[model samples]
Target: MLAIPAVPDVPDVPDGARPRWSVMIPVHDCAGYLALALPEVLAQLGDRDDAEVVVVDDASTDDPGAVVARLGQGRVQYRPNPGHLGAIGTFNRCLTLAQGELVHLLHGDDTVLPGFYPATEAALADPAAVAAVCRVRDVDADGGPLHTTRSYRHGTGVWCDALESLALSNRVRAPGVVVRRSAYEAVGGFRTDLPHAADWDMWTRLAAHGPVVFVDEVLACYRRHAASDTSTRVRSGANVRERVTVVGVVLGYLPPARRAPLARRAYAYAAVFAARTALQQVRAGRLPGAARQLREALRCLALIPRGLPRPP
Candidate 1:
């Protein structure tokens, strides 16, 4: 049985202390892009008396030390892991070290718009909000917009309805979301074991605990490049297994009565994703890869109840 680790409690803010926000950026061989991302992050600081920028270098052979060192200053807190901890481990460590009201897991290659701080500050004024997530624009490596922002729209505020939406698809891009320090700690932060779907796991856990406000405005830019891990996941099709693991976690967290419906959707999504992967492999003339995808499809079917409606 996999146990969700306990998220540590954040200390109470001292009176008169400057309001601070902790931003964690994890990078591996992303030197070329951080140059643009770092400055944009600093610009979003606004009037906050304190802001801590945590950058973790995951043992990249491409001189990550030199690149990060150049960007480091009084406001930026940089820590380089001894060796490669991979992206998930790096993010977990970053969250563990945060001391602020809000935590932002900004990817090393992604940049926030100038208005990000003002928008977040206003939304978090509500005491019930555990997280404030805004719209995000996907851009090429050079920061050109891919198209209209990828929509994660559901409603203005977080509630049970948002949880159902997430079960269907992960509309919340990892970077655009800002989490309360206490909320993140309560959910035990990110689970390193599920490296591929760590963000999905965190989002699910957070939604289960509290309401997540969706700010429809696009406050950040997600930089997409061929070399990015996400692109690699699409090319190799490992996203299917990760999504399966996520559904299992969701089912484990839900009540028995609610499990069947959620499981049905999950299994169907897994089957479709696996079939798509198999078709892609066939087109590439890789017989073995295609066969493996077919096997995955069968496993997905086994998880679904026989009488459940098929996923669209």
Candidate 2:
């Protein structure tokens, strides 16, 4: 349904030997961070063999392959794109290349804690679960702890309010969630148009199919740096504009009766975020970016037309 590229034939490997998990790290120009991520991933694997670690470089100028070679040797596979495809392209490419039942779309820079795999695997062990999301701890570029995502549940269990809650706002960070590959096939690839907010679109869609598991403990680290896409969007005011589009797309997924109230809630939250970013931009003398953010704040439900396209 996602119109993904035709997958190649699987050369049959005995079930015991084939990898059950693929930790695919999609990267652009972030080799320095890749150096740190590889070891942490492998360390969790230990002597276990049912995991594949891949670095899918998005035609970055720097050499992340050397980092993979130095740290991983043959354990980690390094796959480089022929050309630069930006975030949307690279992420789709990672999905295409992934060869495991469970897919972890880890960033080139992020690292999972020692307990992450075990915790997530435990949650996914529930046959009804289509995906498992762990709480995320935000870290600075130097890997210093910033803050953790607010917990949606009191402790680890099924996320009962997942769909309605995510329709209002995305709480997922890429490294913090491990998704079943089947979920991707069902939802389709990330929307090519929503570059800045595709993950939000994807997670919200996934929540609809899920008995999603919430691992309340913070098991994944999401790095924040000036060069990161989130930061760039904030500086340019694209975050607000992109979120407005994503909110409209997501509203189409819910029942008509719920859309009005949720749309109001979503738009208000985005407006508040934009206003806060606008003030920060003003303090930094980025007047144009501040003005751009303010303009997006006023783009409410009326901007979203009727007969919107729903998720696959």
Best TM-score among the predictions, by candidate number: 2
Question: Residue 152 of candidate 2: its Cα lDDT?
Answer: 90
lDDT of each: 0.74, 0.81
User: Where in model 1 is the C-alpha error above 4 Å?
Assistant: 10-14, 68-73, 147-155, 271-312
Tell me how far the alpha carbon of residue 160 in candidate 1 is from the true structure, in angstroms, after superposition.
4.8
Per-residue alpha-carbon lDDT of model 1 for 1-312, expressed as tens digits?
A: 554556666556678563468888888888777777777777777335677777777887676556657865456766889777788778877777777778898888888887886787677888788888888888887788874444455545544466766665566777788998888777886776777787877887788788888777888888878788765665555666677767767555556677678778778878987888788678868667777788788888887775232321
Candidate 1 has what TM-score? 0.83
Structural similarity to truth (TM-score) of each candidate: 0.83, 0.89
Error of 2 at 41 (Å): 0.9
After TM-score superposition, what is the CA distance of residue 154 in candidate 2 from its true location, in Å? 0.9
Q: Candidate 1, 44: how far from true, in Å?
A: 1.6
Model 1 clash pairs? 7-185, 7-188, 158-212
lDDT of 2 by residue, 1-312 (tens): 232333343356786876788899998889999888887788887457788888999988889988888998589999999898888888888888888878899989898988888889888997678899989999989999877998899999999998988888888788989988877777777777777788888888888877899989989999998888787888777787778777778876788888877877877777777888788779879888888788777664344343332232
